[model samples]
Target: MDGVDLGIEPGCIFGLLGPNGAGKTTTLEMIEGLRRPDSGSITYGDHDLVRSPAVARERFGVQLQTSAFFELLRVDETIDLFASFYRHTLSTETLIERFELGEKRKAYVQNLSGGQRQRLAVAVALVNDPEVVFLDEPTAGLDPQARRNVWDSVRQLRAEGRTVVLTTHYMDEAEALCDQLAVMDHGRVLDEGQPQELIERRQPGAFIEVAAEVPITGDLRLPGLERVTHEGPKTVLMTQRLDETLGALAEWAKQEGVPLTGLATRTATLEDVFLQLTGRSLRD
Candidate 1:
């Protein structure tokens, strides 16, 4: 990543958001001292990462995208193994209970569910009792309920006064968790701010959504219309003047004999901000 500069605040959940191949993982790895950047400085307060990566390693806990543990090791044993590497560590029992892994404490690593494994990974990361935690796609693949469970854990981390640097492509995750956000695309930082601030600054207008079957074959001729695009089975019309756009849309629908099925209007979100900056959807 080039021209990337970010300052993560203490005791807040900071998110590095982008799609796959957008360099989110690379950025997180660099900060975690897993990969060194060719040039640029990484510092936590007075500690310089380039000159002293050990300091970062000692102070920051890491949960990689894929955490591999011995398949035969029990959950408690796995936590004990990771805790052995740190000078200062939390109690394994507390860690297991915090992550909601007490029921699977005796289960082998290979037998746990995907959500359980992910929780165990985060628990292992916290074994060091580090001040800052780096989580790379902490909730990548899981059911909705599992994803929400991880979210709760992350919030608890912030509540405990630990700085969390998380990378995720899920817009809802960013919106729900991040106190500060750095939107990245390709290999550069696009924008940085709080979730709502970035959305209002980057995509300040409202969006009008209609069904794709309405057959909009050409550019829409609505006042204050910024752009029109297709998202799955919906046609989205972004506009600065919501009243004028809605009036024009109603007239146009009546004139064209098109049914405005599933019509809705709402404020722009972080997903809209990402698309506005990169010209690509967050899921793409």
Candidate 2:
């Protein structure tokens, strides 16, 4: 992790996005004082974190990828146990309500569902009421509903004026939740900005996806077509002019006697940017 410089703004939900083994967790651990970099500066406001690591422990809240609690402990009891570690902490009752864990407060940690366990994990992180919260892969294994629940909790943290730094491999999660994002790979940051800003910078054109019995040939020329590639059963066309490209594409299909099946059009996304920069999918 050499020369990894970042400026995380106050009160913003900053995201660290990358694939597995990309060092997102290592970076977050360094910032959260769980692991120390051999040499680097981590400054929090006017304080230098490297010089005073204890300051980070007091001011930062952390939720790791797998948050484990005593299986026998009730939800409320788990929160209380973590609260006991901090001199200043939010009330356990408030933490439960904030994370929508009121109904599960009496349930043992082992009995809770995946979403419930995740909510409890977040509740524990907030027990310290720290100014900066770090979450690593907060929504990695949840279903859509559970993932949305986590996203809401994260936004609430930002609304309360706490700086939230999270790491995720999910592109849509990064797009919807992050106020600012850093795209990382191989222990380095490739780009950083708002989600849409990075998408526009890395992949400016719109995407046209079409499914055909016979894939389009490489030498085929279509108006406004910038690039063409295959993804599974679909041929993706990156186009500069949507209308011109669509019309020309339809005509070409008709001339070639090929049916354009499952045709779709949409703007570029963060996944596109990651692929462009790394030549690999985020899931890879």
Candidate 3:
């Protein structure tokens, strides 16, 4: 990671938003004391984390992207095992109930479903009852319902007054769950702010999308239109004034005998902000 600096507020869900290989995990590891940086300082309140790694180990809980537990260990046993490592910890029974794993408490790790495993991972992370939590791509592989379940758990952590820091590649997930965010790429922070603030600051306009068959071109004259680009099978028009742009687009399509199939309009999103900053899509 290069020159990445961030300030996480207490009791909020702070996110590191980036694509794969953007150094999100590396940054998390360094702060968590799993990997030491070659330079720079890390601190928690007045404590220098670099000089006092034990402070971080004792005060923070982590849920790694991939967690590996003994396949034969039961759900409750896994939580107990982790709790044994901490000087102060929450009870296994409490964690099991809070994470909604009561039914699976007796089930072996290998028998749990994807969502169950994710819940178990989170449950174990809280065994220490730390003041801060670190979740790395917590919802990366879960289905929609399961993803929402994890989202609820993250919010619950914040409600309990613990600082939650996470990393994610999903634009919607970051926008929905994060109170503050740092947009990172190539090991550097591009911007940092609330989701809507970043969107309004970096991408203040709205977008008009129509079927590619609409025959709209960059040279087309439309009031309030700023730029035009093609994405997949849709033609996107960026406009500062949504009402005037839509009116002009309809009139132009009518005059040119073009059908406006799949017409849609929406405000700028985190995906748009990322593209504008990096000159590429998140998947790129």
Candidate 4:
């Protein structure tokens, strides 16, 4: 976080990505007015965030990683309580329907499943009808279907022209939802760009992956290979000159008497970009 000499465009979904304790949450907290930066400025639209935080709050919606809603309160009661803080709010009926909480509207908050609780928090965020929304790990620990549902609401937010700033460790979610993003590590921005553009910049060559039962001992310095890296049983080779690399590998496989196993070549992706930027797997 070399101070965001950056701005998240209105009506855009901007993702902040990093591993745990990399300061992604810190940066987002500062922007959401949950934590103050030790020495920097945050301006939200025309409001001076430091000087007029209340004004900024009137326009900001934030969903923290962990919510502390009253466990004994009904879903409608929780929504109503939060809505009372805002100048304007969507009706409880509409929020419940939008979040698919209709069947559970009268249920206690603590009785809701993890995914349901997450959705309730999202619904609470929108109660203010703010101009900007921040979601921190909105779908962490969720099942596949639950994650997809969360994504659907985010897409709906984009369609409604609301600015969203999301912080998540999941690379696939960043690729799917973000138009522009910054990857952070150790409280610093390591890379920033459109996901596809970043991938192209990092790996212009084809990346072939090989997971061998045996280790590759020697450095693979062939005529066509551009880069070689190994992690445990996995190895990735980058090559612009694909034909030559594949041909040489075929010859070497025969000569060395090693089986070519778990070999695959796919177009580069955001995961590759993260790997190139951080020198580690995104999930690591």
Candidate 5:
């Protein structure tokens, strides 16, 4: 990580968003005190975490991108094992109930489904009842329903007054769940703000999507159009004056004998802002 900086507010869900190898995990490890930076300071309130690693370990709970526990261990036993490591802890039964793993309490870790395992991982992370929680790509491999389940858990943590910090490559997830976000690429922070604020700052206008049998080349000039980009089969026109641009597009299509098979207009989104800033898709 190079010169990546962030300020996470208490009792809020803060996110670090980037694609693979963008230093999101590395940054998290440093802050978690699992890894030390060569030159930099990591602070938590008045304590310097870099120098006092024990302080960070004591006050923060982390669920890594991948967690490995003994497959033979039962769900409740797993939570109990982790709890024993911490001086302060929440009860295993309480964690199981809160994370909706009550039925699987006696089941082995290997016997749980993907979603159940994820919930179990989070339950173990909270064994210490730390003030701050860090989840690294918590829902990376889960199904839609399971992803939403984990999102609800993260929200619950905030509602309970614990600061939540997480990393994600999913733009929609970050936009929906984060109170504040830092967009990162190539091991550096490109931008940071509230999701909507970042969108408005980087992509101020709206987009009109046009679908045509033929390619909508840039040569087709339209009034009030800022730029044109092709995404898959759709040609996206970015513009500030929506009405003027729409009128001009219709007129141009009519004159060119082109049919507007599918046309839609909508406000800018975090995806648009990411494309504008990085000149590539977030998934890339």
Candidate 6:
């Protein structure tokens, strides 16, 4: 119920992702030494994470999917408290500016917006100047701009030579930040690879999205199409041979006297890769 097999490498953002109850968090916790695995080994760089947990704790910064902080304490004060635990800490003024918390530094936790609180949480995690960072759904509830802000901070971590172990349901986020990733399900790793590699392996052609009021049945086979499926009134075709598929689709439409008013084609993505492997939606 609680173990993982992650062959992590340094200077990489490794994403371990899954739906609820998939043990993603548990796997991360074990690696971070926050919880003991029932039976497994967690080696980070040269340190045995489970055997030398004290060493692991000192080398990593942690941000849980959800966190609670002192509502009465000011933002800067909260960071100061966590800073006191470590031998070295980032300057309060620098951290405040880094996370764009300068204005809210004196504000109590309860008064901050959902996004502000998340930034503060990240600020506190980096207070220790850790070599690796574990961020679980760091931008889960943030708005678009706030999410981008968090993404920028993550890039800075990588530029600073800090490894990041992250988990997120946002497929785009994984593509944007991670050097490699693993998609999990039912407490097992379903797929793992670089974002580009996974997409290339799973699908090779541009996605042609065809929306029809009627069923897309009756032999509307497109050339180079490996698969065709329905989502609501839309039919998606995935194929490496797009020219043949498009020709076949055009003929099929003419023969059936059907109109694909919303037909669109675009490159494959991490989201498409996940759907091809899982056969289920990420939000599912």
Which digits, one per residue and each the tens of the lDDT, describe model 1 over residues 1-284?
A: 78898988999999999988889999988888888889999998998898788888877899999988999999999999989888999999999998889999999999999999999999999999999999999999889999998999899999999999999999999999999999998889999999999988988899998884555768579999998887787888999999999999999888888877788999999888887799878776
- The lDDT of model 4 is 0.85
lDDT of 5 at 16: 94
Give all TM-scores, in the order shown.
Answer: 0.93, 0.95, 0.96, 0.92, 0.97, 0.93
RMSD to native, candidate 1: 1.9
Candidate 2 lDDT score relative to the true structure = 0.92
- The predicted structure with the larger TM-score, 1 or 2, is 2
Per-residue accuracy of model 3 over 128-239 as CA lDDT, tens digit each: 9989999999999999999999999999999999999999999999999999999999999999999999999999899998894645664789999999888887898999
Q: What is the C-alpha lDDT of each candidate?
A: 0.90, 0.92, 0.92, 0.85, 0.92, 0.84
Ranking by TM-score: 5, 3, 2, 6, 1, 4
Task: Kindly indicate the candidate among 1 and 6 with the higher TM-score.
Answer: 6
Model 3 TM-score on a 0 to 1 scale: 0.96
**Model 4 over residues 1-284: C-alpha lDDT tens digits?**
56565578889899998888888888888777767777778887677787667766777888988876999999999999999998888888899999999999999999999999999999999998878889999989899999999999998998999999898899889999898889888888888888888877877889778877676768676667888877678788889888788788878877888777788887788788877788888776
lDDT of candidate 6 over 183-247, digit per residue (tens): 88788887888989888887667878898768688555556887787878889887787777788
Candidate 1 ranges beyond 4 A from true positions: 212-214, 217-220, 230-234, 255-259
TM-score of 2: 0.95
**Number of colliding residue pairs in model 4:** 2
Q: CA shift at 84, candidate 5, in angstroms?
A: 0.9
- In Å, residue 200's CA in model 4 sits off its true spot by 1.2
Write candidate 2's Cα lDDT for 1-284 as tens digits. Answer: 85789999999999999998888999998888778899979999999888887889887898999899999999999999999988999999899988888898899999999989888988889999999999999998999999998999899999999999999999999999999999999999999999999998889899999999887766779888999998888999999899999999899889889987779999999999999999988776
